[model samples]
Target: MDLVDIDDLSVTDLGAVLDRAAELKAGSGPEAGTSAGQPLDGQTLAMIFEKPSTRTRVSFETGMTQLGGHAIFLGPDDIHLGHGEPIRDTARAVSRYADFIMARVFDHTDVEGLAEYATVPVVNGLTDDAHPCQTLADLLTVREKFGFDSHVAWVGDGNNVCQSFVLGAAMVGLDVTVATPEGYGIDDAVYERAAELGDPPERTTDPEAAVADADVVYTDVWVSMGQEDEREEKLRAFEGFQVTTELLGDRPLMHCLPAHRGEEVTDEALESDNAIVWDQAENRMHAQNGLLVWLAERS
Candidate 1:
């Protein structure tokens, strides 16, 4: 099965992955790629990247290596999809060589196409529509800190990351409140899906109101990778939404990093004692390790 979105796995499966990640973090897992730990011992992963990345690339590669699997990085220049090779053709070819395929691309449909054609399981490392991997790590981090009962307030663009968080949080039984500019609300399809999972996030344009009763406050960059042209506009729209020390009070902060400090979040808030961003970042590897192990077992 491919992990192209948050709902691809049932609630039980998601819980299993999170539980395994917690166990791995506590040092209960077997040795890397040895004995019982090496579930993907002879497997290979082919990663296709149409956009640049740091955490996504490093985390996946390191996670695969630690799992006793090899990962091949194919950057934009290395891939021929832009040079006229069809996505289906690339998917078919890669499936022959790799045990799994992971693609970080601009278009969500591109990843969908890869999954449609590839025989091996396909994972969406990132896309314009969703980021299940990051959501998985965020869930793990939240579970470690506040469990599933805490209320999470999201203050920023209702972008792909936010959409994924909304859906995942709903499935895991967390209350979510999203505060974004009027014109920058969460996607309709994603919100509807989130409602299906559980309670949909309470929406608002007032960031402060959203965080009033929040146990954890989260934010992301005002402008994403492909939205460079909209930077100035986005900045203007998200002006009053920054997660400042005053805004957070004693509530912990969460941010998917490569943060545009002073924009969506303040340095004071990020460096504060209540911030759990680092733990969230580190959990990327652990959560993904659980996902890989689970996928291996199922396959």
Candidate 2:
């Protein structure tokens, strides 16, 4: 099975993964701390990146090593997919050489095509449409800071990260309120998917209202990679949407980084004691480590 989206795993499976992630972080589980009995010993993961990254690449590569496995990084220049080779061909070739494949690509269909053709399990590290891996790590971090019952307020563009978190939070029964500019709201399909799981996220145009009673407040860059041309327009649209210290109001802040500090959030809010952003970043490895182990067992 491939984890290309948040709903690919059931609530029970997600719970188990988060529990295992905690155990991995605490260094108490059988697969913890570069131990000899590592579950992924001798395994290999092929990482294909169509876009630049810091956390996704490093976390997955390091997570493989900690699990006693190896990871091979393939950048856009190193891959044939951009040279007109079919995704199916590349997927088949890579599956034969590696135990698993993780792809961070611009097009969502690239990973979908990989999963469709690869014999091994394919993981979507990130895409334009969804970012399930990041959501998984975010969920783990949120669970640690404030249990599942806590309310989360998202204040920024309803991009890939927001859409994925909306689905994952609903699956875990967390109340989520999203505030985006009028034209920057999440896709209708995302709402439909979340509603299928449980309650759809509350939508609004006021960031303050969204975070009013929130236990945690989250935001991301107003303009993501490939959207540089729209930066000025987006900035104008997001005028009052910045997560300043005043906006946070004692609620813990979370940002899937590479934050445009002055744009989506203020330095005071990001560097304050209430910012769990670093913990959220560190949890990426632990959460993905647990996920790799789970996927290996099933595969």
Candidate 3:
């Protein structure tokens, strides 16, 4: 079993995951990983990352600790895969000891390759093609701030985060509108898939149009990890898409964090009451806690 994307979980499963997260956050569930109630007691989680991360690393490690499990962080230098070992071979070998594998890699195919070989559950911490975990937290936070039937807007690059948001919106029957530049918009294939989720999404070049009447305004860095060489070009392309406080106009806002400060969004917008970034960021840990418990129980 693997969580490569939100689509991996049906609406029922996604709802269950969120419900469990609420229980965990409310302290309504039994102590996880403890002898009396720990569902993952003595379980070990293997976390592999080729890219640098602050939240992803901390959240997963802390979630495992809180649940009475151990999380071993594996950096590029810590594993043979860093030294040219075949991904499948490494995946198979690691599965022998760890109960689950969570990988944050530059390439989506690498995560997929790992999932194909690992005997245990695999989680997509992140990838170039999708960031499902982050979107899960985003959805959860939006639900917390405002009930369903609210409109959300994405006002920057239609990257991995945007893709995941679209899919999540479709799954939960939430409405989302995205505004991005021509070359930097959502991939056609991804948009096509989203169209099937429920209501077709609106992807446009006008930032203000999307921001207007939106309950939640979200944005991400124009330049993502592994795209450093294209930073100058990206900045130029995304000049009109910055999510300013004025654009939000009292609407709550979200960013996955590690924000560019002035690129994708202005500092005013990020610090204003409209911003729920800290809560959104914190929910990553709680949501993943629920997801981990859910996956562990299945195994």
- Per-model TM values vs. the true structure: 0.95, 0.96, 0.95
Worst lDDT 10-window in candidate 1: 28-37
Per-residue alpha-carbon lDDT of candidate 2 for residues 1-299, written as tens digits (9 for 90 to 100):
89999899999999988888877778744555445247899999999998889999999998999888999999988995635888999999999999999999999998999999999999999999999999999999988878889999999999999999999999999999999999899999999999999889999999988998789999999999999999889999999999999999888999999888788999889999989999899989989998998888886
Q: What residue runs in model 1 are displaced by over 4 Å at the alpha carbon?
A: 28-36
Better of 2 and 3 by lDDT: 2
lDDT of each residue in 1-299, candidate 1, tens digit only? 89999899899999999988777666634544333356678789898998888888898898888778999999988996635888999999999999999899999999999999999989999999999999999999999888999999999999999999999999999999999999899988889999999999999999999999999999999899999999988888888999999999999999989898889888889999988988899899889888887887888
lDDT for residue 136 in candidate 2, whole number 0-100? 94
TM-score, ranked from best to worst: 2, 1, 3
By lDDT, rank the candidates, best first: 2, 1, 3
> Which regions of candidate 3 fall more than 4 Å away from where they truly are?
28-37, 80-83
Q: Which stretches of model 2 miss by more than 4 angstroms?
A: 28-37
What CA RMSD would candidate 2 show?
2.0
Model 3 C-alpha lDDT versus the unseen true structure: 0.87
lDDT of each: 0.89, 0.91, 0.87
| Candidate 2 whole-model C-alpha lDDT, 0 to 1 | 0.91
lDDT of 3 at 156: 89
